[model samples]
Target: MKHSGSLLIVDDNPDILIAARLLLKQHYQSVKTTDNPFDIAGIINEQRKLEQPIDVILLDMNFTQDSISGKEGFYWLKKIIEQDANIVVLLMTAYGDIQLAVDAIKAGASDFIAKPWQNEQLLGAVTAAFSHAKDKQQVGKLTRQKQGLNQALNTPNFEFLGQSNAMQQVFSTIEKAAQTDANILITGESGTGKELTAHAIHQASMRHSQTFMSLDMGAVAQNLFESELFGHKKGAFTDAKADHIGKFELAQGGSLFLDELGNLPLEHQAKLLAALQNRQITPVGSSKAVDIDIRLICATNDNLDQAVSEGRFRQDLLYRINTVEIRLPALRERSDGIPLLANYYLKHFAQKYKRSLTISDDDMSALCQYAWPGNVRELAHAIERAVILTEGDKLDISSVVGNSASVSTDEKTQSTEVLNNVAQYDTFDLDILEQRTVRAALKHHQGNVSHAAKALGLTRGAMYRRLEKYGL
Candidate 1:
């Protein structure tokens, strides 16, 4: 297959230009020759306009103006690099001196090729130069992408704040662990702010200035596991139209946060273990190994110890990732922090919605008492929802959490009675049974969608769809 890289040969000798172009054109898609060295810039700009920027250039080291010393080649090379450092240049001269070759490389030329070069030698040099140029382009692209992501991530002030003793312990651990490069394992229930904790650690670490890439292990499909985390070459698979950089490569010299890590399949866990153990990854369909240097941080809601006992999670992999385990407490377990978190979100959403709103002491007390099944995330959603729905200046506790969130024993009994009545209406019809079951779950959980979804063995999204379908 012909390479996509465009090639240009610039020489005062027409015979040399013709000979080189003829040989390169067979291997490359676009090969152009120019006798005038001054036309290099215009040709490069024209190719870029055509959306096929010049990738490699072969320039004679000795032009008519400065034939012996190769001074003209250095000038043109400097000019070419200044135009775009990504464009690979191979300096060519009949009088090839070893020191001149070293100087050519130091001045940004990709390689030095002697004139009257063998066909094989010339082809090899151009191929290597093209590869180097492509690598440089990939690096440049990743740098820009990382910069944009960092900007977006840094927009919000680090809000991983809490005053509870449990959270204080977590913060202390983070402070100690962030100084080192040990892999960190964060385990907690859903909505417990595992990703936030990971980000906090990344921000506090020595790699704070570098990229912090977060990958959702559960969201990645089983078939795409290797390609997604380790990367893939162009034509690696049916849909792989171009060489793709994976999370491991993108997070190089930074931190990699693997969220929902317990959901990784047992088979894929082995591959992850290998990469973590070796500190390198081989992109899919490519034999070359790319070394990686990243601070590994993984979060999961699943009980990995139990998983290991059941042979669902590999023990060796767990040992590799869990060098420093930081277990985040459930919101109910750290109720002291609820007031701080609640007020923070309250003020935030109040400003966001342009409402002059305040939470009453009774509502704040109720928020602190409620057993938040979905943890801090649930609290945030509750505050945001209440801020949007409340009509009064003071936030309503009933609106913030469900009506039954901190109800008395009598109210709890009444809610149970309502759930019993909902179950009494069970019909054999699948739609009716499903709707009734959903309503009963919602009533039992005091209208907490996350808890109700869990009770019915449904995802939050699936539960929302059912709620919309039944208009409930």
Candidate 2:
């Protein structure tokens, strides 16, 4: 397998690239070279998408014409790992730069070589890496044997549903990280389907056939954090009538999704970090260290960076879990996807409740226009409520957004009265008055043009021109 593996050598030096390519050509099935380190991510992603990923990357430690430091190598190594940890990278450096290449190992490079090396030394390192790759693939297969394999595939609610560009990047990240045993940290505002995304990742992963266990850190009591995560022996405590397996043991060889990760107790952060670092857990009242195998996925609405600054979180723990970070786009950022999500929820709940329902175009537009402060969760609840309450087959969003986005029926009547006063002004002085009125409305709204436009009975674009014309 090592002999048949594909190899990618990235270096700014073409002569060295040619020599390395020629040397490895006899053993490796394919040898590709690139002078640009920036293009490696795109190349690797494209290769993985085509199911022809490179097995190993021989990377140079320096790139700048006048530079000697291996900073360039570390940058590319991180980029490569962020894309896919499955690709084994061996950093290449001259004898004087050997220390820098060694530093790359801490940055995720599998191995490093001092250049002007023997042919046998490089071959041996590459051979060992392919063997390691084979072992890694076997671990994935072993994890896939865990219980509840089909449950994930059958659950439609766990599906990743989005066609927006943001979601495309998310899906791509999932594809790259899922196959590897990398710890993934998913970040987003609440109700953006963080758990759903975690489930989707598990389903797409090599561990899909295994059990996907999840626990809400915010819901778990501070006292129960240890017992819940690391199991409890019988009679370990007053409530421990029977031995209980923890999430760690239950999800062994699979994935454990820790939702609300930021809510974990400060007292227990160090314990959790130690267990993760050592890949071992000690049960309550048990002296034996239990070997654990779990791919970790954690999600949080709270900012951990802020938490670390406040000394509430362990920075080391953050580094351990965030091997790859996937940030989900909020519904407001991907407003175009609202109709799609709305329709999806409509059909799902409609079938569940045995109801006939459809959303009108005007209603859809209103739903999209309304700022979803609560993200997709609010939109979903609104749809479900509208479907259940409406007497007609079509959904009436009037009741849904009356207090927020849509103009109330009573307000419409009052607006009609305000329009009547417009003609009372002198026609020649209307322009002067219009500018003054626009400026006053904008001032009242604190220069929020959209609110000002709504207050002045003008569209946002119309308000823009009036502001520009008057320079207000």
Question: Which candidate should be chosen as best, given lDDT against the real structure?
Answer: 1
| Residue 393 local lDDT, model 2 | 80
lDDT of 2 by residue, 1-472 (tens): 4277678899999888998988888888878889999879777655554445677899988899877788888888888776565678898877445556557777888888887778999889888877766675556444533432433334545246888899889999999999899999999987788878898889889988887888778657788888888977644677874445778887888899888888787778889999999999988856678999999999988789999999988899999999999999888788888889999989987887889889777667667666665577667777776778777787766656653224654553444345334546686577788888888988899989878765554434446657777788
lDDT of 1 by residue, 363-456 (tens): 6766776677668877787788788888888786566445643576456446545533543464556578778888998999999998887555
TM-score (C-alpha) between model 2 and the true structure: 0.54
Give the RMSD in angstroms, all C-alphas superposed, for model 1: 11.6
- For model 1, which pairs clash? none
At residue 448, what lDDT does model 1 achieve?
96
RMSD of each: 11.6, 24.5
Q: Candidate 2, clashing residue pairs?
A: none
TM per prediction? 0.63, 0.54
